[model samples]
Target: METVRTIDLLLDAFGRIPPLLADAVRGLDRAALLWRPEVDGRQGNSIGWLAWHLARQEDTQVAALVGGEEVWRAGGWHARSGVPYDEAAMGYGMTTDEVGRFDVTDGEVLIAYYDAVHARTVEVIARMSDADLARIVDRSWDPPVTAAVRLVSVVDDAAQHVGQAAYLRGLLGGPEAD
Candidate 1:
């Protein structure tokens, strides 16, 4: 595939996916939000947990990509000394099984929060010089991936999970699957 602008890729992913996923969960009643499908025999994460997890993962990985290595290295990021970080990390929480249980049940807030995070990521990428992009850094256990790799991984993970969330929503009788 031809190389594309990172900003283009990021925006495209966000624009195409979030709405569909959000729509999938829109109008869901409480039980629906907490609905768990038995896929191969196990209960899947609830919409609330999924949303919280997605936001946490994205915020953490994005911070890492931009040089904030320890932003979310531990569970403490979600604890007392960590509420601020956790709030930034997710926008949701771990205890809640589905989106309906979150402090902000409005899908719009979740969508907007994700957009803001993506915008910050883009800004960070833009600020990186070519050298910075090519520079290798150890951000995880699987050896060092370049700044570029981390950046792409962050976007890819977000998109993949958004799709997952949408799928879960569909399984729960969301609009997309109806």
Candidate 2:
């Protein structure tokens, strides 16, 4: 069997995430896009939050292992989202109430955040040599993680949350792409 290259795997994962998220956003009025489900007793992450969280996760991963501060940390979005920042400006994953304080009402804010995340992902990944992937980096929680693993985690989580946003959009009777 042919061994798939690391870049190929990363791109494959990256390719699957955005369309789903875009689909979820397409045709959504501001209200429906931000609507939280009540019946499911869900914490109800709006599409905005999903986008914000995905970008924040990417920023953290890239910053933690790849070097540089997270974009959201520097931008004050985390605090705007009610998340407290570390001295270095990393988020500890704030509560829903804190997240509620975020100004998610603006579609442009979320879109811009995602755009930056995408650009940053490309910029960071382009600089990573194979040896760079093997270097160990300390994570904010639990155990130290490798650059490779963290990269995969960002891709996987982005896809998962995009699917979730898609599902939530569907539940709100929004039009999905054919």
Candidate 3:
């Protein structure tokens, strides 16, 4: 596919996430949002934590791609989220305990944070040229990562998490949860 078309597809995919997530958690109270299923005596991730993780990942990864400050800091999301974490915390490699500590009870704010990050992602991708997409962004892998690869990775991660959130909401027995 042409590079611009590819980016446009990515933008459309990314644009769908926030509303899907919003629908998934609609009518959920703070307690419901924080509910976790148990497997093997350990609590699974809650809807709140998953949503926060997705937002943080997108904010950090997109910021890196664009060579700009993260929306978490630049757009005041850290304070807006009222989550009591440092600006750079993106939920990667966190311990179970650390994951359990994510306590953003207000679903509206969480969705807003995701919206801001998604907007920045769309803005950045809209301006990218084919040459820009082909440039290597990370050299740590056996095959260096290109900007296109990184963006695709973000999309994949976001899709999985959002799907999981929707599934969990269904499991929680909310109306029209599916």
Candidate 4:
């Protein structure tokens, strides 16, 4: 039996996220994309916010690994998104108010941004070598983090957010959801 290369496995896992994200926001209007289950609570995230965060996360992490510029900046997504936030904000450590402030309401734009970031991720993964994967990318952790581990973490985080987006879509009762 031929063992699958690690890069192939990572690529396969990463490939699944974008389509799920697309389906989650498909056919959703601006209201639906921005809807939150609780107007005064922090129990849920809007579909638009979740999609943006996930794309930013993947874009930043993968760009760091590959030593390339993020698609958010290089692809002119900030201006195109008209998100009213800085280019560097990736939804990490964001307060409830800040999350609420993310006002990207166009589902098509959100999906397009995600698709662009995902394409960059796929390109980086395709070009990674065994040595690159084994190289340590971060040393702040106790055991240190390798490129392979960082890639896996990125994929895992993306999968969770995409799943959350899909759940929100179902909760909001979209036509193409569920």
Candidate 5:
């Protein structure tokens, strides 16, 4: 049996995310999408915020790997969604107040942005060679981050956020995607 190349594996993993994300976002009413659960003085993220963060992180990371523009700004998502384009804030290290202030209540916008980022992710991987994947993208950590590592990190983050959104959807009794 032929072993799957790392590129193929990465493509397959990224391909699986959109449907899961769609299910998590679909049929969610404004209330469900924007609902922030709180327990013991800690606030939980809403489904909308999860989706938004996933897309933003993926967009930022993948763009960095490809040495290009993020889909969020290049694709005019920020303008279309009425959210300010903050290149520095890719939904990482956001304080509780900042998370609470994320006000994209429309599921359609959230899903659309995620879809756009997914498209860009696939394209970037398709255009990459083996050497590109092995190249170091960041050296901030003790172990410098490679393109392959960054891609995996992006997918891992997206999967976790997708699961959180789905859990929130189920708790709110949101309908399944049609």
Candidate 6:
């Protein structure tokens, strides 16, 4: 709820969950979790896929920033996640078929993975000084990215994805939201 300071802003942005993602995930059957709306013969992203992607993105980014192993691999989530293998795979450039192949049955697993990533991110940020936050961690851009910017990027990306997941959850109705 505190968004005044930089760290608080990141936490507030990431922890902002008015939509209640756990409600979108918990108690939902596999069919409901993986349902993608078919529109004009194109299938949209599923709630499960969005959550999985968000977790992967956050896990990879936070781990890289901290120079630590990804919670996905470290926590053995890669083995548990039924998706196909790619050491760097975080749902980026995944084909529609690949997205469809994401066969995570239990929502609890996704929730747990996300929770671990969130915890690690919080831990890392909590210990960082203002100088640490200002340190350049990425150099791909004209102006290198700082730890603070990177963390905000993670928060921004996660918010969009989780918001999409929530939207997909809302779209499920009739026999679908089962």
TM-score of each: 0.65, 0.76, 0.92, 0.94, 0.92, 0.89
Leading candidate by lDDT = 4
Candidate 5 residue-wise lDDT, 92-177, digit = tens: 88887888877664788888998999988999998888899999988997699889998999899999999998887777752453
Which pairs clash (backbone N, Cα, C closer than 3 Å) in model 6?
A: none
Q: Write one digit per residue (lDDT tens) for candidate 4, span 1-178.
A: 9989999999999999988998998788888888877756554678889999999999999888878899999999998987868989999998878887878738898999999998888888899899999999999997999999999999999999999888888887535555
Q: What TM-score does model 5 achieve against the real structure?
A: 0.92
Clashes per model (N, Cα, C within 3 A) = 2, 0, 0, 0, 0, 0
- List the pairs of residues colliding in candidate 4: none
Best TM-score among the predictions, by candidate number: 4
Q: For candidate 1, lDDT tens digit of each residue in 57-101? A: 776776766656433343333442212233454543443233334
lDDT of 3 at 107: 79
Residue 53 lDDT in candidate 6: 89
For residue 73, what is the lDDT in candidate 1? 43
Q: Residue by residue across 42-79, what tens digits does model 3's lDDT show? A: 98888988888898898889888888898889888777
Candidate 5 global Cα RMSD: 1.9
Report the Cα lDDT for candidate 6.
Answer: 0.81
CA deviation > 4 Å runs, candidate 4:
174-178
Residue 151 shift from truth in candidate 5, angstroms:
0.5
Which pairs clash (backbone N, Cα, C closer than 3 Å) in model 3? Answer: none
Model 6, 68-120: lDDT tens digits are 99999888897776656565789888888888877784888888788888888
Worst 10 residues of 5 by lDDT: 79-88
